[model samples]
Target: MQQCSYCVNFTPAFQIIAMTKPATLKEIARRLNVSVSTVSRALHDHPSIGLRTRTQVHQLAQELNYEPNKTAIFFKQGKTFTIGVILPNLSEEFFSMAITGIEQTALKHSYNVLMGQSHDLPELEKRITATMKDHRVDGLIISLAKDSKDFEHFNQLDKYNIPVVFFDRIPPQKTAHYVSCNLRPGISQAVQFLIKKGHKRIALINGPSSLLATKERMEGYTAALHAKKIKIDMGLVVSTDLSTGGTEDAMKQLLALKNPPTAIITFNDYVALDAIRYARRHNKKINQDLSFVSCANLPITHYLDTPPLASVEQFPREQGEKAMEIMLQLLTRGEELKQKGQFFQTELESRLELIEP
Candidate 1:
């Protein structure tokens, strides 16, 4: 017998083609000699269905790899059983931790999540939001991008009766459901700690001025300075896009002053890391010549040879979990409940540790 050129064994093409199609409820019913409705009810564990019959249906479904039609389910329930999450940057440790909480909570509620990263671009964020709408997600969880100014994209979701829950970097909308950490106490404490250590000239390397978190942190910084009777120095505070290069530029500018700040506070760990590198290259030692503090106490800080003076624990994971919980409530509850809107303010304890060289 002549062997086929593609393979040594002669496998029939029809067999390969047959395996590609997925098993369906109708197929299961046909095989089990039951009605399609009976199979569906049994799979759903409907109370009307007999226990033995349900068990038989489940066994046959496992054997045939039968999967329910989600489209039909959606039609019946008026929900997609899916949630959409939009983040500024997926690579950021804060967002990464938040995603874990969001995903875990979503899974517990039998809902799937679809994630989109905007990379801090307004246009891209709009596009991603549109895509989420097209996917017909039941609800949304969002952290606004750094440069996001236009919120009209979200209006479409509102028009379609989709609930939105904001976390971390939320938008300016007052009526929206959101979860955020109260940054004032931690930031104020950090500044107070620095002042207690006799550091009068302090510089702030902040994220975009448009961001809510940045605004809050700046307010906290200024309040602390005012409390200590120190005049607010506008020149000492630098705003950046929070990119590595942006942070490095801000550090350079601060270091070039005739009387530069003895201490620096940054937006997040990545910005702090960049500032530290820049300071070291310019002959400044961490915790010696220059004291540094930042937000988002990432795990890497603990492992660093020379960690920052302190890092404000923002509890990204908890923020994510709370946002998910809020979203779930909005989805499960009626439209009237969603319209009421809820805001969760998480006041995580601030952790401050001064590193000694």
Candidate 2:
């Protein structure tokens, strides 16, 4: 009297067959009163299969809980309708929000996403690229890791003709279509705001030197100071890993300086939050003793004890949306696909005033 989930009759052997054995074209043809070849063509919604008959066959197959074998579909179509996403880490709020945008876009286009986190490791990024190629993802979206300079890992995708678009943390080389914030302007805005508040002695907490964002931020920071006639002080610019430990260590060093900066600009909200906490530990009041601003703001910054004096809000979701849109256009429009191997650049940049006490 036990019930089998897959089969209505619930016979042990039939249950095994229903659960483990895929419904074949012949089995479906027998059930639908059609030949095996007719069933095969109907499942693909082939133009030769009359619409009414195809609909009837498909409905019956659905009722029987039949699932198409993905391997067979890939072999026949040469496409998996699957894309891959490579990120530094999904645990970050910014990247997680970007993922939501990517998912919505992929679903709209009837494509699947395969995600891999490189964790800022070049070797892992290479492995992920290889795996996605083996799986034959139709396209790829990536935010390269910090240490990734040589893009030979992505060169293989050219042979497969799978397009790769770079977003957020992209490389310096102009190899792929990219969607990102215009960091120089954002950083310039943040630094200018701090200077307006009478912070002539300012410092910069930056990411690694090799990173594209970090280099652009540094340029902006230097430009802002130079425009204001403030001499560039090498001692005040601290390059940190942007992770908690490295940021904390950098904060200690910056604060311990002979003439510590009264204001600091950071790479992202997390580094800014760490700076605030580190300042508090040293008995320094946030806005009074040490004002802080960051380039990319997130939701968590608003909940802090003393919110950032200001933050630049780069629209990460919009970046993700636009990146996918470009890739989809390349995939669907045959004529437009002639623009393949072209680098399309789109920038999403915004600034927000956090206005802390």
Best by TM-score: 1
The deviation in Å at residue 5 for candidate 1 is 6.6
Assess the local accuracy of residue 247 in candidate 2 as a C-alpha lDDT between 0 and 100: 92
How would you encode candidate 2's per-residue C-alpha lDDT over 280-308 as one tens digit per residue?
98899988888888866788887777878
Clashing pairs in 2: none
Q: What is the C-alpha lDDT of each candidate?
A: 0.86, 0.83
What TM value does model 2 have? Answer: 0.88
Name the weakest run of 10 consecutive residues (lDDT summed) in model 2.
334-343
Q: In lDDT terms, which candidate is top?
A: 1
lDDT, residue 68, candidate 1: 77
Worst window of 10 by summed lDDT in candidate 1: 348-357
